[model samples]
Target: MEIVPIDTPSLGDRSYVVHDGEVAFVVDPQRDIDRVLAVLRDRGARLTDVFETHVHNDYVTGGLALARATGAAYHVNAADPVSFERSPVKAGDLVEAGEAMRVRAVATPGHTFTHLVYLVESAGEPPAVFTGGSLLYGSVGRPDLLGSEHTRELAHAQYASANRLAAELPEETWVFPTHGFGSFCASAPSAASSSTIWRERQLNPVLTRSEQSYVDEPFDAYPAYYDHVAQLNLAGPGAPDLSFPRRAGTTELRRRIVAGEWVVDLRHRAAFAAGHVTGTLNFGIDGEFATYLGWLLPWGTPVTLLGETREQVARAQRELARIGIDRPAAAATGRPGTWTAGPISSFPTARFADLARAWQHRPVAIVDVRRDQEWRAEHVAGAVHIPLHELPGRLGEVPGGEAWVHCNSGYRSSIGASLLAAAGRRVVTVDDLFERAAPAGLDVVSRQVMA
Candidate 1:
């Protein structure tokens, strides 16, 4: 028996394919099931079971279609309000995979009411538990995603869930959780990906802290897309639509933009800022493209992708499909000469060092377009704290001066600078890592800003 980890880097999600010679089970798959299918094919294994820990709030799950395609029994929480038929499993239920592997459902509710952790017992190996969101490496999943009113109740439940798992499982059991590695679902940032039950009990802040302190712990602001993802996941997300987008001429692209659809330029940030089609936004495919695009895009609204090459746009479409943003109504990919029409726009970018030097000669107001939790942790002494999502509505709050904008790694600040430029605001973009500013002679301030 062996377990393989498949990392979906865009969403920081990890799915597993646990196999025992010929039979296998897939756990918490992402919307794109191709990777799981490929793994199964490579191993010459038959997929017999598809399992989900909960109704996910960050991205759609492809378990239903994967089960349908492979004739596997789909297992999910019985209490979840999903429309599709599934083999509902509750606590204490054991699922047999093959001669050497089995899965045991353990009710561990905190991230959601119906959450479950699966304990896997395989031949010749120590027992390991798929903890899901209940117990993570350094921290646990946040409990308030269901609603703000459930914060205290869910936090208390989380405490109970952690204790229950620790008592039920042996200290040598391997702990695997789905919500940690660079994901917003975690209550605290994670330092590692995998841990043992004994190590987690010794080092996990969520388990060691007092119940009230853990409950009162602040959480980062969830993206607006999370609300949409929750509803779609519960209703059973549709299969990925792999059709190529209709290549838009200049006219159709303009029509879509005029009709309130956005033109997303998926080029590199530097190329995008140098010159792009006016009114289009930049969500470069270099880093976590799907996650950021899913967060910013309006649900069901049409979007046209503009990239420097055809392959770039196609790669972006594949990434977007994982988050259920498929079938882009129009796409344009070519050198700027073949594609863009009318006046192209550009924004001036400055380095943190340059901005710091200029700040001494003149008082500048920097726009820190990061999440509130990030801003509160550390920021420039007098930077404005408007998150990237709220930039449009709160544009007026940015005081007029030598305005400079930046995010942690400069991805979001590029978007913020474009929006401000489109709104006729003259601002210099600090297109550099915000954390690197301290060594570059910029004064940094830190605080425990509760979300």
Candidate 2:
């Protein structure tokens, strides 16, 4: 038996290819199906089944596409009522692959009401489980995805479902989860691709916590387009051609940058800050670049890139393509003076302690770039609240001073700081202000007074 995990960096999603001898099955396939087909062909395995652990909210799945291409049976949870060419898989439903591999559907509906986890039972080895959004490495899926009321019910169900799995599965059985550390599906770091049930039983915080705490803990905020992306996934996405634009020379790249076209520097943050095309947004190609790009930039915006090299640019293009944002007009060659105008500057970063001390001496304005809910919940004393999305238009509201900026995390702060700095305001980012402020009792400033 062979299990291959395919990590799609753009969406922070993982797809699986499980095969035994001549038969193969794919689980939660992303929009790219050719790679899966190529792998199966290389191994001389016949594609037999494509399974969707749950309907995704981040990227489109290729279940239907792979089914149409290879004439394999497509399976989705029976309770979902999803409108696709899928065979409804309920609890106890069995799927066989050749003479050696078998899968049993277990209804696990905490992430969504219709989610399922597959229990893989091979001919001679211990059974392994594929827990989709229901169970993750460190955290469980946010129950609030379906709405507050439904979330409560789902949370209870999820806790019960998890308990059921823990009891039924053996300690040594390998657990292959759908999403890991970097994925927005769960807050836990998905650095490890797979883990054993024993490890999760011992280390997974959410799984060990009481049911009430598991449900009530504040899950991180999701991007605004999550529902829209979910609809796309349910509808299924067509295969992308994956053919991006040719890399242009330094002059042409600079010309495009001058014409107000956005250049996304996909290099590491340090490499980008050291030297990048002027006015380029440094959304490092590491974590959730595609998701953030959709939030930060307008849809259908013409974009060039500053990758480590031409090959890196091509990889970045593929990452962008997963989210249906594939307009790679050109690539910058990292030549100095190529981009001469349009905010040739970088945002400043500072420690929260330093900003707090500076605030005591002078009237330095603090800009909280977190979401409206988060701002209302807790923010720094005397800080002006402007959500990152609304900051571009409300710049005039920001009082001129040595500005200090912060978000729930540093990503939005960097973006906000960049824009403010570009507009000629001195800016400094407060790294880890939320964690620091909360314990110090400085986070709970009066909202009424601020308003």
Tens digits of lDDT, candidate 1, 1-451? 7788888776777889989779999989888888899999999999999999988877778888899999999999888888989999999899999778889999888999899999999867989898777898788888999899898898899989997777668899998787787777877767686788889889987777788988888887877778877777888876797666889888777777667687888888888878877777788888777777777676787878888777888878888876777788789887555555777778778888988888888877889999987877898877789998888778899998657999998888888887777667777788898878888788788785422
Clashes of 2: 3
Q: Lowest lDDT 10-mer window, candidate 2?
A: 335-344
Mark the 10 consecutive residues where model 1 has the least summed lDDT: 335-344
* Highest-scoring model, lDDT: 1
Full-model lDDT, candidate 2: 0.75
Question: What's model 2's lDDT at 61?
Answer: 74
Clashing pairs in 2: 180-190, 181-189, 181-190
Note each model's CA RMSD in angstroms: 2.1, 4.6
Segments of candidate 2 deviating more than 4 angstroms: 78-83, 190-193, 246-263, 271-279, 298-308, 326-333, 339-343, 346-363, 368-397, 406-412, 422-424, 428-451
Model 2 earns a TM-score of 0.80
